[model samples]
Target: MATAAKKESKPNAGFMKPVTPSKILAEVVGTEPMPRTEVTKKVWDYIKKHDLQDAANRRMINADAKLEAVFDGKKQVSMFEMTKLISNHLKA
Candidate 1:
């Protein structure tokens, strides 16, 4: 008789604690209280809709009125920088 060997299993993703949704931030731009994920989605939506993304400078996100408020009066922010700036508006 041959003995069988056990295979190691990968850890489950759900074991990690879920992130709590922070309180929504307000901007002159919209009334929706979107979570960070949703907010990011919406920002992309707006960017595409407005054709704000520069073809030459893909990293820069140009702000409309709503985005300006969320971005702390910045007319533009880098893609990576936007995430950090948005986090500031979320309540602890």
Candidate 2:
């Protein structure tokens, strides 16, 4: 049997760099600057904690008052669209 070399990987610098969240986004994710990855995690945490996902369609996230502001008044958004919307609120 032959042994194979293992590959090592590092996190992407762009994703690791800290970003400031917009005032609307701050309500859910906090006011502190955080990496994009952490912002996403915190947003998801808020969603899950608030039971914001649609019952029929788990892919859809129902926006609460705070999230609605971040979502630009959208009452609901798909999980895929959620990321795009969130990116708009992040400042480098």
Put down candidate 1 lDDT per residue, 4-32, tens digits, no spaces.
57667865554232233333335432554
RMSD of 2: 1.8
lDDT of 2 by residue, 42-81 (tens): 9999999999999999999999999999888999999999
Off by over 4 Å in 1: 1-34
lDDT agreement with native, every candidate: 0.65, 0.95
Candidate 1's C-alpha lDDT?
A: 0.65
In model 2, what are the clashing residue pairs, if there are any? none
Per-residue lDDT, model 2, residue 27, is 88
TM-score of each: 0.60, 0.93
* Model 2 whole-model lDDT (C-alpha atoms): 0.95
The alpha-carbon lDDT assigned to residue 60 of candidate 2 equals 99
